[model samples]
Target: MITLSRRHLIGMGAGALAASAVVGALPASAGVKGYVQSTIARMSLPEKVGQLMVQEVYGVDPTVDDSRNLSKYGTAKGVDVVRDLHLGGVIYFAWTNTYDNGPDGVAAASNALQEASLETRPKGRPDRPVGTKVAVPLLIATDQEQGIVTRFGPPATQFPGSMALGAGRSTKDARTAAAITGKELRAVGINVDFAPDADVNVNPDNPVIGVRSFSSRPDLVADMVAAQVVGYQIDGKVCASAKHFPGHGDTATDSHYGLPEITHTPEEWKALDAPPFEAAIRAGVDMIMTAHLLVPALDPSGDPASVSRPILTGVLRDQLGFDGVIVTDALDMAGVRQKYGDAEVAVRAMEAGVDLLLMSPAPLAARDAVLEAVRTGRLTEAQLDEKVARVLTMKYRRGIVERPLCEPALVDRIVGIPQHLEAADEVTDRTVTLVSNDGTLPVDVTDRRVLVCGWGATTTTAVADALARLGATTTRQTSNAPTAAQITAAVTAARSSDLVVVLTNNVATSASQVNLVKALTGSGTPVVTVAVRNPYDVAYYEANAELCTYSYSPVIAGAVARVITGRVNPQGRLPVDVPKPGGGVYLSFGDGLSY
Candidate 1:
């Protein structure tokens, strides 16, 4: 008889796991599939349906209800919701006040939820004298994508966003960053991360997915996506979810407020949008979150991909051969809720073959709808069992079943340690992209006055502080939309300073910021412009020297400072094309410079 430790099984990766199953090298109970089957057979219909739901709740403590959550999401006390609804998972958001108390608080809250999920319960009647513990454990999840989308604040290592990694063009860096992120998440008991966005980001004007996506090139995105999948799930410590399936990259719309439609032909999709998702599937990603957009090439049913059988079942499952869990994006978003009510959307999503219903606005109503559908023949009990089994299988495969609780005391020790912070800084240093230089870079700050001015006080202050630490005298001016007085003041300051460094946030769309850059550049003081949010802003205006950091995190600001001061060479290349003012490409993808 062959025996494999849980550690060995998790490290085996998805391909190895399947191969092991084919050879019958382990007992049925030791294999995830067999354990999931036996667990499903013992579950009631209500319990089975509950296993398909993952809700978002408010509060740092599971036993207490936050009034804000009740007012905003209408969620009850965290422990009660998990116990009463028998939820298979829970998602935490910073806005929901879940991270208000920091890492230890998060770990404690996660332990409470897990305790609730593992509690014994009556088999049928609430008044029963004897009861049994819940069969499956909860999958605690969060969007700790880092960069601009981070949920955890300081004391947690903040890595650069996806585009920054894309600019660095190192799969090793991508994997290392994800591994650090996974370690921190597992330390706090979050087992699932909705991250490493797989969208190709072909549209420069894309509202939602710009820097969140790795790159515009499908091949590059595919490589980075696969690397991150392995990184997050390497030891089965956390499950990685490659999101916005069938692609949400080329749309000009934001799915949170409205529906976005993609006009890719079948050939176009196979070439552009399908590569990263295909790569993710081959990498054995734990989940693929569906996009709420309509892709007519894949599904002509007029329903969004989240509820389209042709796309979810036909394209993703049949053609793509993805046998893992399929999760829907937040059902409360306007993208998926445009036509259907809460109840109907829940039923239709299950019909379309999604395994998990994430963050439904009305949890009880959604669960009741699924139960009714199963009873009334709209959805078969067998279908419900299949979905629940997938969820259970993932729980076991990811080691959540055996280790549901986290140690709060160790959270501080394991999260944001020195080595992880150093890795983040090294990655950030490599992502500073110098797009243009006219012999003004590596500023001689020794005895020179430098003025740092721009939008976003946090970003400006960070840059100024970094410069000050290097023994340069610096002045700062911050305004989101500079007024005439602010512009005049900044220009006056620029004239007196030996050099001026101006930071811009989407200058292409903000005429005021463009005017600020124009006024400072016109001062003839040798200005260096930094594009903080998107690198495409540099095309709108002229600067003596320009660089793109892709994000405005303090770490990125420090990296930008070092690049300008010649302490670090700018090594990052553009991940997407930057359009010129007249509509052609000013800076194509892969454009960068070094001193």
Candidate 2:
């Protein structure tokens, strides 16, 4: 299994040129190949290494500029280093994305970043004409895998989560939601969405990806993944990464906390986990985001798939034939960061065959590590050339070279517009799943006394608004965590009212939520429970009627109320299976009973 490094041919240019067919294993686009090759030819070793590292947007201030020392670039502020470090991209986390994150602020930041990304100092850099603009664009990427994983928003209309879309079961709706998602992202100059999770939610007890996945069935997940790939890539040209590949669905462990493993054999892997990824590739997905999953069946050494040669190179690149960009999940996660520094992770990840190093904590240090790896005869120059060329091809394919900057006025106008909200409402209306009922729903609000007890800020308001609008004599009580007195008050209110509507969250995480629901139902009044976050609540507490609305967005809440009042028939099916209280099957996958 030993292959010599191509470091011996550093000075030999034309003779050392690798096969064009194998250079980065690009898509069948010849022009992109030529552009990538030419781009690679002009870049320095430092620039090429820098292009592989993607950093978080912390300390990145595009507004700051410091003069170069004719031999080196000085000063800090990550955004200014776009040109200095020749960075590949910066991922927007919640902190930086929302720091002074007004529409105008985002536009200014984006403009500054693009400007720096396209221009460079005339210091210690060669192979470029004086004052010439760089043709490459940074991959402005973020995790807008909406419905739990959202980085930037408020001006963006909130769509129902992915599992909700699966329950809705319309590929068109899924695409439309992502179209809106993409357009809003592009409005703010984010050109890549690390989204449309391709994991099939087969485990009922799966923690991180319950409502995030489209469905428990592989076929349904494939459909939603393909649809979202089209939706994000089509209109705004924002690249979509069909994510957590080969699959992160069935694992009980959270990658954020510890490494999760999949012990299936190769045959079982293909049958259960690989379909969505296969479908995503077929759908022309621009990027595939790898998970930190350890598949002992694939790689016996127990390397996380992010750095597993068998998985990334053998399975993803060779077996599945995904020629587009391959990106690692955030390198800072506990799953992959076990005693590995930025330098070690960056070098090995590239060796494992990933194109992009996402969310490296010390990105500059990482760039230097790879640079040292190349110079010290550890990593080959040929590897750097191919990797950087692949990234350039991706930038070209995404049209970022031509149009890197976003329009500020258009951003304000297009993002979170009425049409987007309307479309979002339409999708949520379809995604509300009526789990079960004993004829307790459509709680007539016309002069009927109603008691509303809900969790969270938005959900409480939305439920109260819907009831008030429906002509119900409504009394509202809100608590994410209710005191004993508060619980008694809610029960007292429920007893006095004709019917009670309860909105709750996270029955699996908190037993207090289960207790809250039990107390509300104890009044023996006709009680309707809406699982505000996770749908597994019905397994713990019984309500006269139960519905699972994947999101508690104002629009989704309104839509939930409409469904309960029989305004819109609850059409969404259960995307994941819900286990029974005593530990057997309660609602199987695809179970949704409507009035």
Worst 10 residues of 1 by lDDT: 18-27
Tens-digit per-residue lDDT, 379-468, candidate 2: 899987877877787787787755666666687688888988989888999999888799887666788888888688667777877877
TM per candidate comes to 0.93, 0.90
Candidate 1's residue-wise lDDT over 463-495, tens digit each?
A: 888888887899999998999899999999999
* Pairs in clash, predicted candidate 1: none
Clashing pairs in 2: none
lDDT of 1 at 329: 91
After aligning candidate 1 to the native by TM-score, how far in Å is the CA of 507 from where it should be?
Answer: 1.8
By lDDT, the best candidate is: 1
The per-model lDDT (C-alpha) reads 0.85, 0.77
Q: Model 1 misses residue 440 by how many Å?
A: 0.9
